[model samples]
Target: MGFGFVATQILAVSLPILLGWALNKLGIIGGDLDNRLSTLVLNVALPCSILASIDGAEALPDAGTLVLLMLATGVTYVIAIAVALVMAFLLRDTEDARVSYRFAIAFGNCGFIGLPVVGAILGAEAVLYAAIALIPANVILFAVGPLFFIDATADAGRPADRLRGVLASLKTPTLAASVAVLVLALAGVNRLGVAGQALGIVGQMATPLALLITGSSMAHYRPLEMLGNPRAYVAAAGRLLIVPLASLIAVNLFPLSPFLRAVIVLDGAMPVATLGALYCLKSGRDTKPMMQVTFLSVVFSVVTIPLVSLVL
Candidate 1:
């Protein structure tokens, strides 16, 4: 069953990626089409999914599940940050590399990859669990990840400007969606049946659109750029393997719900997020490493994620 679930997830994700590649190669989808698809996924599809998931799962969560999630996530993040800091300090000697290291360590493509994969393995219930996991992950990605990059680049420019950059990023649809979901969830509005149903319909679009954007973007993937980069290899190991592996080992000592344990490990195993580039672009850091990290991490996650799932 685990193998079958993993196979389904790989197919679901890979199909859209192939479609995106085909579309882009055919010139039927390029330029503004990519941007529009991204906007649709980031702004509309994602927020709707969050609201819908919360609405669907709104009964006060099971105590065991909630505790399991908190422990798994908390342990994973703590270990990831520690390992990332050590890795960054080791790999980084230059200003740009240091900042890029921070982004590589902290951000994982949880939404675009994690949710769908988890949903495939564990079902929509697991997606809801994954969504809860993303709450903190996205916050760190948007709020903290860029700040590290900006600060790293501070020697080249004034440090204070990074504040404005962070503020500006607050307007992005993904961050805005995070806020919206949290607001609606806390207010108990998503629990209302009519509102919940509407949210579900919109939310359903997130996974498919996200996969398509991934596929399209990946269609243009540059293997030469990523294949031999030592930094890229390190980042991939950190995000797709080491960080998750460390978390899994720690999780073994705890008495958490099996589902939540599985979800957390799965989330940790996701590839480096594409948003790392957005952070680099916005913060005046080098984007090359971020791209490398993202590409390699995604490339290898096909093997890494299933391995994590199996052990869990």
Candidate 2:
């Protein structure tokens, strides 16, 4: 059953990529569709799925295991980032490569990839736990992830200007929406039936749209350059395999609930967030490598995610 669930998510994620590629190849979808799909994903689908899965979830798991799992994740991410640093330095990679590698390890595709994978592996309730995990993940992304990229390039403006950029990043609509959904779920209000139903419909769209957008973005890549980048492969391996394997070992020994354990294990197994490309763009780094990392990470997760799921 668990393996089947993992397969469900793997298919859900992969279908859009394959479909988008096909549609583009057939001239049925254009570049503009990618932008629209991205907006639908971030603005509507993601929040709805979260709300639908978590709303009225009164049987929240014991904090002991969840807390331990969260801590384990944080520790694993820190370790992965350290490994990425060593890899970047050993290869004599550029500042952008270092930043991209670190960011890839630091940020996992929690919502875009994590929610559906958790849902399939452990049912909707696991996704509820995934929502809980997202709080800390957001903290790391909006606060810590930015710091790594910020220093990669020089600041041309005053200190105040730099501070403002950090502040602006904090106000991201996606983060704000995730927070809103979490707060409402905790309150147990459900926001009435129509609102919840509407949210669910939107949530269902997120995975497909995200896959499509990622696929479209991937259409811009150079295959030889992508294949030649060793950092991208290592980064994918660290994010999809090493971190999750370490988490699975810790989780098995930690006295955690099965559900929390599942969430933690899946969270660690997530692919690299495609948004890393945007971060690299903002930080004045070359985006081609980051895109390569994202594309490859998603591809490998087809095998890695199911392996992680079966272990959980």
- Quick one: best TM-score, which candidate? 2
| Cα-based lDDT for every prediction | 0.72, 0.70
Cα lDDT for residue 9, model 1? Answer: 70
Candidate 1 lDDT by residue in tens digits, 1-312: 478777677766777767877888888886788889878877777767766666656454554655566666766777887888888888864777666766676567887767767776777767666766676666556666755664632463555675676567656565555555555545554464887788778878778777777767776667797676787688678888788888888877778767777888888788877777876787666777777778878778777877877778
Clash totals for all candidate models: 3, 2
Stretches off by above 4 angstroms in model 1 are 55-68, 92-94, 151-191, 252-255
Query: What is the Cα-based TM-score of model 2?
Result: 0.85
- Location of the lowest summed lDDT over 10 successive residues in candidate 2: 183-192
Worst 10 residues of 1 by lDDT: 150-159
Inter-residue clash pairs, candidate 1: 17-215, 48-203, 49-203
Q: Once superposed on the true structure, which residue ranges of model 2 sit more than 4 Å away at CA?
A: 1-5, 56-58, 62-73, 152-164, 184-191, 250-255
